[model samples]
Target: MIWNIYLIILTYFLLGGIGFYLINRKKDPLVARKSYTKFIVYFFIVNGLFFSITIEPVVFRYLAMVITGVGMVELIRLFKISGYSRKSFFATSVVIFILLALGFCFFATLNKNLILFTFLVLSIFDAFSQITGQLWGKKKILPHISPNKTLGGLVGGACVALASALLLRKLLGVSPVSLLFLSAGIILFAFLGDVAASYYKRKYEVKNFNDLIPGHGGFLDRFDSLIAGGAWVALYSQLADI
Candidate 1:
């Protein structure tokens, strides 16, 4: 598991560096440099610590959450310097941490089915959202920000997510009812997360959260869905177990 985690981090950094180079090629050199710097710092502080927390105990996890919460606040503050102020962004981050902490406290004993379902729901939605948004998106889903997003893409992504959930259920032996319901929740929340990230980027007058991935945007850009999806999964898993 440790080796797998290390590999994942290495892959993320390598991919992120490629994105930085690509976007930088078209933009002002100074802006690109700053973006890369921000990306690395943000990735290390947020994702690095996050993975560490996952491998640590509950105490360490809480500490990691606190750090992440602070990091989110700081990132928002940085954006605000450019003229964006959406209080809900920070609020949601806080709420997510709170919920996750609660789950750790209460639901750690639950069956892996609940956890697996949650992860499957999140992963399917996230993968489908990106795939669909990239391929079939047309009309702007949010014109003010994230102009590339489309209603068609959203629907397509949801359909893909549903199909993926069903497939996972068949292969992984998850309950059909649970898979269906979880997939629905995942689809809705994944959309919410994507839109929210778009709003944040637009409000800050920036394109992509940070240039950290090759063919992808930033750490936040890639993981925005995971943040919300993971939190929702943890909470839902806990509730279901109860």
Candidate 2:
């Protein structure tokens, strides 16, 4: 079990390195350095969270709380940087959203399989989205929000996620139909989550979340997709258990 996870982590980084290198090959040297640095930080954080949630599932709740607190701080900082007063509606809405995500994280801890499912999709879907998008994307998906986002990337990401699920069906011990449905959910929710995060950043005129992870913006920036996707995954996992 542990070795399987280690391999997943290794695969994530290997693909990530290739994708980032490909995308940033022509960009400034600073970009590549930052990408590699943030990759290292991301590697450790992901490993830490995975071990806690899998080996010691009980710790997931506490870690979820930590994630929540960190996100709140990062959001506050982002608001300040935007030089805007905190709107009550925006604050309330976001607080509710974040809390809802935490609820999913807590619930997922009850089953190791569910927990693994959440993280695996997040990792695979995200990396391929960028890699495929850069290589074949031509039309923008959400040009108004994130100019970099492309329809081709979205399709590519979803396809890769679904294909990856074929292999996961064995480990998850589910029928192909069920796994495909789950993959579809991951693709939809994860992309929406990422878009939601991008929306906020664009609204605030902030480049990244908070620069917590060097190349990757702030903590919220990295976990934005997880926050949203977790909410959706929680429902799916619950239904799967039924």
Candidate 3:
């Protein structure tokens, strides 16, 4: 688990660097140069620390949650410096972090089977959403802000997520109904995350979140769905007894 987490963080940092370079290539030379370097350094430091600390036992999950919350606040501040309003952006980030913390606490004592299922469902769905959105998107699903998102992509992503969850459930010998419900919850919350990110970008008149990912966006960009989906899955898992 520790090595897996480390590899994931490393991959994120590498991809983020590539995205920053590509996006900065055609922008204001000075601002691009400064912002790209600063963003990469801050993102690496914060996320590296986050991933490292989060691999501890469940007792330390709260600390990881707090670290992630603080990192999110810093991200909001960066967005504010890039011309976003501190009020709404910070408020949203706080709410999201709080919800995530509460969700973690809620499932802390739940059955490991259910908890693992919830986590797997959300992770797979969130990843599927982004991959599908980027690879095959054409018609705008939410044209006002997220013009790149397509209806077809959403369907494709959702199907893939659902399928992945079912496959994992079967492989792990878990409850199929529980997996399906959890997958459904994740899909719903992932959509909410996508819209929330879109709304945030539109409110601030920004194209992408920090230009940190090639064809993707920032940490928030990739993480929005995961955060929301994870929160929802945690809550649902707590409520359901499977």
**Per-model CA lDDT versus the true structure:** 0.57, 0.74, 0.60
Greater-lDDT candidate between 1 and 2: 2
By TM-score, how accurate is candidate 3? Answer: 0.62
Model 2 root mean square deviation, Cα atoms:
2.5
Model 2, 22-42: lDDT tens per residue?
877898888768766776787
State the displacement of the C-alpha of residue 225, model 3, in Å, after optimal TM-score superposition. Answer: 1.5
Quote each prediction's TM-score.
0.58, 0.86, 0.62
Query: Clashes in model 1: which pairs?
Result: 15-213, 15-214, 16-212, 16-213, 19-213, 19-214
Candidate 2 ranges with C-alpha deviation above 4 Å: 80-89
Q: Can you rank all candidates by lDDT, best first?
A: 2, 3, 1
Best by TM-score: 2
Native RMSD of candidate 1 (Å): 7.1
lDDT of 2: 0.74
Q: List the residue pairs that clash in candidate 2.
A: 210-218, 211-217
Q: Which stretches in model 3 have alpha-carbon errors above 4 Å? A: 1-67, 78-93, 104-115, 134-136, 170-175, 211-217
Clashes of each: 6, 2, 0
lDDT of 3 by residue, 1-242 (tens): 43553464466456546655665678798877675656556554445434433443364355436534644764575566766556776677667656764665555445544444455555545444544555566677688877767776688668876876765564336477766777888788878876876777677677666665443456666556655765686677557744
